[model samples]
Target: MAAAARASARARPLAHPNPGVAALLVKDGCVIARGWTQEGGRPHAEAVALAGLGDGGAEGATLYVTLEPCAHQSARGPACTDLVIAAGPARVVIGQLDPDPRTAGEGAERIRRAGIAVTVLDDANARASLSGYFTRAEFSRPHVTLKLAMSLDGCIAMADGSSQWITGEAARAHVHAQRARHDAILVGGATWRADKPRLDVRLDGLEARSPVRVLLSRGVAPDGVRVINRPSQIGDLEGVQYLYVEGGAVAAASFLAEDLVDELHIYRAPILIGEGRRGLADIGLTNLADAHGRWRASEQRQLGSDTFSAYLRSR
Candidate 1:
């Protein structure tokens, strides 16, 4: 299941309008076929895996899938549940159930009725891989990730307002990778005007993956940038499943205050800058206790001279 979940990354963000999914055909403790959702979401993971086999490759094999096979038929293609039924896998292990109302639980029921064994697990990794799809389905908005790069003393800039290169090259590269996974990247009006950042992915082969540039402001947006007056306006960004918020203090605080951020990515450098600009302004929290259970650390890693930590909203 974990391997199937990891395989979903190959199709994520590229499979917008459809949940990125992966499937593996295993027999006698060996994988016979592997496939992920194709670009533009055609042919689904199950179909792709089944098609990869020479002939009857799925017969008596156990199929592991990150999400349940979609049962609804579409003009684009046949129903995935129908494809799986025809492939005739002996057993099906689903990491997570489909959240879409049209297919929810029905896909598994259809497969089970065909005399196939079905196992559905409440897998965290599978759910995490589909976070953007799940968020949009449940909340009518993108999954928000707020990113902040600061110093040991939690400062984002020097006393003179010079904030260039807070972290090393590796950390910057890491940030770019994160940007590529999101559908759009946003910054506060102050940061947009002060830094004039291009906000585009610079990685060698990933230039095309650069997300849409967005500015958080009431004023007119620049030539190519999109604008949103308030964080809630993120819901209006049609087709944007994931939003990466790179911010100035005010913007970060605004999103945090409204509890709009779903994930936090922090990069801390080795140096300290006392009496400098803080990483974030007040987030409307009067009591520290209220903040204690709001976030839970999910990842911590070292990148060059900086350390990166990720936290997920506890709720």
Candidate 2:
């Protein structure tokens, strides 16, 4: 089940409207087949894995899946539960339940009715892997991650708003790689005018992973970016499971104030620009206690002279 969750990571940000899922078939403790959701979410993980099975096949084998096999049948694709039932697996282990209204728990129920043993396992890793789809299903908005690069003094740029190179090349490269994992990259008008960033993934062979560009502004903007007038309207962003926010202060603060930020990425350089613009703006919090339980640090690593920090929202 843990391996299935890791495989699902490759399906993310593209399998929007569908949870990123993966499947593994094991026989006598040796893996027989492995698969993840494809682009556009067709040919689900279970279907792909079953197709790869040889004559040694799935009969009496155990199947592990990141999410419960979807029960909803559509013209677009075959029902995963139906396929799994026909595969004749002796047992099915699911990392989590599907959150879609149609297949919330029906998938596993159907498989169990067929006399196959079905067990749903709960773990922190599986929950984090499905966070994007879960957020979309529950909140109707994509999972928002705010990435901020700043100096040790809590400054993003100098007094004149020039923050071209706060972190080293390694840190910049890391941000681009992170962009490849999101469904869309959003920026405020101020950021657009300041840097005119392309917001495209530049990593070799992963150029196709460049996410949809978004401009979070009401006014006229660039030619090819999605314009969003307000953060409340984020729920309308179609086909986006993960939304990455690279900000210039106001944009970052706005999402935080609205409680839309699900994760926070902070990149800090050793240098300090003392008399400079603050990395974060007023979030309208009355007391420090209110901020205590809001975010919990999950990761911290050193990248040359910069420090990378990752935090997940407490709730």
Candidate 3:
């Protein structure tokens, strides 16, 4: 189920309006086939996996799926629940329940009605794969990751405001990789004017993966970037599943103030710029204890001379 969920994330921004799903069919203690949701969200994960079976793949195999196979019929495609029933899997292990009102628990219910055993796993990692969809459904905004490249002491730049190369080459490359996956990259007007950042992905063969560039500013719009005057307008960005907020402190803080940030990606170089701008502006926490359970780190690692970590906001 974990592997199936991981595979689902590959669909990303293209899978807008639908959660990318993945499916794996196993029998005799071996995987018969595995597949993920395709581009444009067609040929759903279950269909792909079912088609991959050479012979006798689903008769008694167990199906592991990232999401409950959709139960509601749609003109878009046949209901996944129908397909799974036809395939006759012996059992199904689901990573998470589909949140769609039309299909929520019906997929599993239908499978059980067919005498196929069903199990739902308690897995946080699997749930994270569809965070974008959940964020949009629950918050009416894209899943936002506030990314900061700062000094070990929490400074983003020198007091003079030059912030080039806070993290090393490896960390920069990783950031580029993130850009390739997200649907949009956003920054404040100050960062835009000072950096002239070509928020495009530069990785080989993925140059086209450059996300839509957005500027969070009330000032003059920069050439070639979509401009939103206020943070609240972020919810109006159509089809943006994942929004990467690359920042100057003010823009980063604005999202935090609105409690719109879903996650945090911090890259800390092993250096200090004690007098520089901080990574974020004050978020108006009246008491230190007020911020205790807002976020929890989910990942930490080393990137050359930089320490990188990711934090997801608690529900």
Candidate 4:
């Protein structure tokens, strides 16, 4: 179970919209097959593992899957539950149950009905690995994370939009790490025009994991830039598991208005920019009370002269 869970973690930031799931078939202390959720939602984890099985490899084998095989059928393929049953694995160990209304516990139930011994291990590691996927499946929305770098007074840039190097090297490096963990990074057209950021992860020894660069422009974005006009555009990204909203005020306001932000990462520098650009765009919350209980702080840390805090949406 631990090995399977670790493998699943590797697929994070890569699989989005689709659950980052990994599966392994082990029998008699030897590994038989291994697979993870592939791109574009085709060849699900179960199917990939089963494909590795040659000559009916599932017979008398134990299948370890990260999440309960999906029970619902879609245009992409048949229900994963049916595939597992037909493959005929002797026993199935699931990390967590699917929470989507169409599946919920149905996938596991189907496997049991097929006479395959099934076990659901709700361990902390497994649960954490699938957190983003389960959040989306249960809530019908993307797992959102807001990334902001500001001065002590909460200014993001200068009054004339000269916002560069607000944080130190350490803080900037940390931001790249955050990018590496997400499937996509989004910014508004205003920011794109002003900064022209590469928006790709750049830590040494780490593969250049570039989150799909997205421009939140209502119309055509700048030349050579990837753009999405509406909130609905997110659904088309397919397997984006984690979305990072890097903002200029207007773009942040748009997402907030849509109630699309799921998490927040705020980095505060030691200096203040009293007459600089505002920290955040107007989100149009009725009042501070209206914002109450919508989010919970998840983490807080200090790096050099900067402070980083993370918040998860309460809902």
lDDT of each candidate versus the true structure: 0.92, 0.89, 0.87, 0.83
Write model 4 residue lDDT over 1-315, tens digit each, in one string: 788888886677665557778899998989889888776556788889899777678999999998889999898888989999999989999988887779889999989998999999886567667877865666555577888899989899988888878998889999998888888888888887788888888899664677778888876766655688876567555566687888988888788788888788999999888999986877888788888899888889998889999987776
Q: What is the alpha-carbon lDDT of model 1 when measured against the actual structure?
A: 0.92
Candidate 3 clash total?
A: 0
Quote the positional error of residue 38 for candidate 3 in Å: 0.8
Judge candidate 3 at residue 187 and give its lDDT: 93
lDDT of 1 by residue, 31-70 (tens): 9999888877887988889998876778899999989999
Q: Candidate 2: where are CA atoms >4 Å away?
A: none
TM-score of each: 0.97, 0.96, 0.94, 0.74
Can you tell me which runs of candidate 4 are displaced by over 4 Å? 1-7, 23-64, 70-95, 99-106, 114-128, 131-141, 205-208, 230-233, 236-239
> Which candidate, 3 or 4, has the higher TM-score?
3
Cα lDDT of model 2 by residue, 1-315, tens digit: 778888889888677667788899999999999988888888899999999986549998999998888888899989999999988899999888887778899999999999999999875677788888889878989999999999999999999988889999889889998999999999998889888999999889889999999998988867878999977778888888899999878989999999999999999999979999997788778898888888999999988889999999988
Pairs that collide, model 2: none
> Highest lDDT: which candidate?
1
